[model samples]
Target: MAGRIPHPTLKGPSVVKEIVIGMALGLVAGGFWKMYNWNEQRNVRAFYDMLEKGETSVFAEEKDRGPD
Candidate 1:
């Protein structure tokens, strides 16, 4: 009896293409995450700076002032 043909391979350029696509997708996701969290990061940094500068009453004053 005749032997059956082998399955198609998926190495070389095909693998490289998949890797590139995956990396591009990862970069896009990371960019979106950074963009979404930009404001939160900025606020955290601002709070840290205020604490460093000894502005301990800023949050209390804001609470007393209520909503803008």
Candidate 2:
């Protein structure tokens, strides 16, 4: 065993690659989250507009009621 030389591990490049991949994934996830929130806000604003125009209701009518 003493005659065999130890092999060096390539850790630096592997760690850098991992960090880059993590940042890319984080950015993609953050973008999706922002898009989701924006869509929700837009929908809420549309609903409020409809309500102000008397085109929608906050409570269901008796004829539109479902099973209890």
Candidate 3:
């Protein structure tokens, strides 16, 4: 099987396309990471606020259950 396999030549336009695609992917990933970090920070802040307010059980359910 010594047949010459034809491969598409990677040239200037293809290189530019690759760069643009890579940048787009990076931006999307960065946005997701930012959102995750923001959510984590928000949860931490809420926990601290609960502690500041003297919550005995930080993870306890609210005692306002209406019925069993």
Q: Pick the candidate with the highest TM-score.
A: 2
Model 2 lDDT per residue over 1-68, tens place: 46978899865658878999999999999999999999999999999999999999999777956778
Task: State the lDDT of candidate 3 residue by residue for 2-68, as single tens digits.
Answer: 9999998865557778999999999999999999999999999998888888874557676887878
* Cα-lDDT of candidate 2: 0.93
lDDT of 1 by residue, 2-60 (tens): 99999988656687789999999999999999987997899899988988999764555
**Deviation (Å) of 34 in candidate 1:** 1.0
RMSD of each: 6.7, 4.7, 6.6
Regions of candidate 3 where Cα sits further than 4 Å from its true position: 1-13, 56-68
lDDT of each: 0.85, 0.93, 0.88
TM-scores of all candidate predictions against the true structure: 0.44, 0.74, 0.64
User: How many clashes would you count in candidate 1?
Assistant: 0
- Rank by TM-score (best first): 2, 3, 1
Structure candidate 1, residue pairs in collision: none
Q: Give candidate 2's error at residue 54 in angstroms.
A: 0.8
Clashes of each: 0, 0, 0
Can you rank all candidates by lDDT, best first? 2, 3, 1
